[model samples]
Target chain A: MSRVLMKGNEAMALAAIKGGCDAFFGYPITPQNEIPEYLSEHMAKEDRVFVQAESEVAAINMVYGAGGAGARVLTSSSSPGIALKQEGISYLAGSEVPCVIINVMRGGPGLGGIQPSQADYNQITRGGGNGDYHLLSYAPENLQEAVDLIKQSFDKADAYRNPVMIAVDGLLGQMMEPVDLERTPDSKQRERKEWATDGDAGRRGKANTIVSLHLDPNKLEEHNLALKEKYDRMVENEQRYERLETEDAELVFIAYGSTARIARSAVESLREEGYKVGMIRPITLWPFPENAFKKLPDTVHTLLTLEMSLGQMHQDVKIVNQGRYHLDLYARTGGVVPEPEEFIEKAKAILKKEDAA
Target chain B: MNSDTVYRPKQGLTDREFHYCPGCTHGIIHKLVGEVLTEQGLIGEAIGVASVGCSVLNYVYFDCDMQQAAHGRAPAVATGIKRVRENHAVFTYQGDGDLASIGLAEAVHAAHRGENITVIFVNNAIYGMTGGQMAPTTLIGQKTTTSPFGREKEGTGEPLRVSELLATVPGAAYLERVSVHDPKHVRKAKKALEKAFDTQMKGKGFSLVEFISTCPVNWGIQPRESLDWAVENMIPYYPLGVFKDPEKEEEDD
Candidate 1:
């Protein structure tokens, strides 16, 4: 009921416990190490399971194993570590295993840096692993939002029977903020997983096999289509975004995660200066809040995307824009955290270009 | 009264026929595991992790709950299952290629962590599912698809002795290398499997039984000839015996 100042990584870890996470399997990685470090002590105190796996591959596979056994499991890592987890993630998606993964992202094409960067936007939203798959991904802009989303991700993962990913930049991971852990999204009642391979399924007369392999081409196609149907449901029901001061705005800054916080500040600054600037912050990056763009007023013509990566989210904006609006992008790479002033400058240049044209 | 039945289909194994190659020893090994679980009355509480290989579909063959893990990741998967389902008899049925090659880290670390689980490692010395490629346990001078002329000791290392390697780990409660080339050794292999499972049920840490198995089709030999080949070649190198037995050591002490 009371608020406490907590580190971002630690808050997410505590939120997982509140969300009824039964097990955590992860290997150490930079900027996100606190998640495991905190859980190692607290998970045991709660009489839950905690395993420090040998590598990211082992950790995620462990998650697959636990989830296949119908346990609420979680794993956290940085960008490169998440890249290592793609193989297991693919298997989890293919098998329809429910678990939550947190990527307190840092820069990377390959171990680029250990500072805050949204470079994993594409990796988390798109299928980082092979084949056609998608995670219900969230990119929260603040510590409180990150905590709430991390708590709700478990139920959402169970509801969809798929992995849910929370992608936050390293800044959110390392920053400290006051948060009320008691506040959580409404918990969806989870049906018992009768298909889980926890021995009980066998004892009850119908043994279960949690597998992704469908050797027959026809069967594999059927499975893929079934998964596509689930994903389509997510797109219809789960698109989430926050619109800020966009009623009569002509220019909108599109961003998410830490970048969105910066864009919000820029929007405020431009509004104070008598410029009609607004922002659209996407909370769910996978079923990316395309509805937010559709609701933009007729006066809005230009959409500028700001990102910690070099235009990863910008690609999504372009797709949803469909030539409906003038699009532009401003980005910083390799762990560079751009300031609000930069977004303001970019917005001004974009509007000036539109006026000139 | 009717004469007592000498043998029956194991309740632990499902009705599905094994998909292993005709000459492959995976069937014999699978039977041993199935019988072990059934005999110990652990079938109802057992959870098996099936690894990728010719035995990838062992999930269909095992009547108990099963999880098919990524190639070589069965050990890690079993660890995850056992940690959560502590009362369940969790085990991984992995081939030499799956346990000794890409999944070596997961296998060794699982043992090192003293996870209370059993691993049924089938060391056939060649990759069977992928058409006779050289495996980590492929012996020197052996010819495989990948080692066309023969396996060179310099180009590729000597066969990995997984039982001996795991025996060195302090957490391993039981480690044994057995073969099923003959009826006597087949019984011995099943006994080793029983002991490994018993260790897990008793809450003792990691246990593994390595079967020096044969892949006849991959070896380009008759099924009958392959048994003799395994006895003559593999036993000398992989040496059948209990490599580590913490329970026996305690009794000796």
Candidate 2:
């Protein structure tokens, strides 16, 4: 495969085109502006549609319209832009339209900062929109993963008839890493005309209505129930997590996205210092690896959960643990990323406390 | 003569019935939109965005891909649907309250950006869905639930002329205002709807056709009398005409 050093955001934009995405609709926001800018230049070459919407709301709605027409479409933004798109995302989720939404997350809690942060774990996993719907969220750690995840997002969205989000922190968007452009998946095999609104010629007898409305209470209930069943199936099939040195470990370090990379470094240092510390990184935030935590033995006395936010995923870790063991949460917010040395120090203190107790 | 079958409403709408009050113009507008979709053979390839108002249940009435947006957010949602599915005809059926009030920003931006979609703005001068309230297009000195002592130009300000305001936006391709008070007006309004949809199909960008409708129950008048009042009072404040034609402007440009 031809290797090329590329920024994560640029890789994602190229991957979307390689994945046969027909349109790109987005508004400019920091750390993710490269995505739209790249599409503006490259989409015309591929005869694809690229629209720089007046606002985030308009961009996301354009994605919804394009997705409804059965075209592989995408939209990208940072925290503030993602906030503006929440209503549109909710409607897209409710309508069961397939599309890709890239949130190269920045510091937030209302215009906090533009630095990279994984503070949107709760927002992305537990429905950022207004309805009782779940979007398939993929957390990418590097430029390669960013490209691969965007390519896979289309298939996952179409397979489930739902919106798929590639939640990358601003670090992944800005960081340059070597990516194999030759290994990009070709999505030409996917038949779009079967369900897309690409003119009505071959299928004359059947009338297709792509609506989410059911006036009859019973029919609406049935529709919601079917969606729930689909979600349950996804929970069973799509739960993914990475384990590093879980075997013969006293403590397990839990993290994801960029924080997980930092955790890996800390784990490596702690192992060199003769501490039995391992790490568990969740790739899919939704349909979270609830079983992974349960698989750990009673010997694993302490679980350290690290994130860029204040203990958002720690709540899920505690819920999964069900009070079998206590969990320690460490976080740094407002665009500050915790250093690996700080995590190592924390791990050392927890181990000393265990020994003292 | 086979007159009985001739006047029956098209089969696109189900017989489950609507919650709109007797003589409400929503049913008539719904019938008109459905008929256009049927006549153009665009039913399967059309997606309708329903706005929050008396006609929020437009999803139930229109036999096509229907989506409901928050208040006046239908244009934004329709923009999304149209961009992704370029071949599908996308339209937003919105009320004056939904369009002129909270969703004003979305409407203006969509028009300014020239999104290739159709907007069917139903201006009844009052918020019929959320009880009678002062709407953006409410006539000055016209009474409603909010303006109990009659709309005061000094207090509530003047009614908004949506077509005129939109006509000023450079991206708008076609902007027309029509009423549905009489049979003649109804025919003309249908033609306007067709032209707006045609503009989108030709990829000519944004097109909006505002239908000055009636809310008889909220206005405290009979359906026929409400029509007369709308023609007399509303038409003067919000005149009926094509405010902007992109083709004509292009020749001038």
- Top DockQ: which candidate number? 1
Which lDDT tens digits does candidate 1 get at residues B36-115? 89889889888999999989999999888999999989988999999999999999999999999999999999999999
What TM-score does each of the candidates earn?
0.98, 0.92
Error of 2 at A286 (Å): 0.6
How far does residue A317 in candidate 2 sit from its true spot (Å)? 0.6
TM-score of 2: 0.92
User: For residue B38, what is the lDDT in candidate 1?
Assistant: 84
lDDT of 2 by residue, A1-357 (tens): 888999888998999888778888899999899999999999988888888887888788777766766678899999888988998888778788889999999998898799988888888888888757888888876777778777778888999989988898998899888998656575656875455434342254333445555669898888888888988988899887888998878889999999999999999999998999998888888888876775776568889999999998898898888887768988988788889999999999999999999
The digit string of per-residue lDDT tens for model 1 on A1-357 reads: 779999999999999988889999999999999999999999999999999999999999999999999999999999999999999999999999999999999988897899999989889988999999999999999998988898899999998999999999899999999998878754554676887998885448888999999999999999999999999999999999999989999998898999999888889889999889988999999999999988789889889898998998999999999999888899998999999999888888878887898
lDDT of 2 at B130: 85
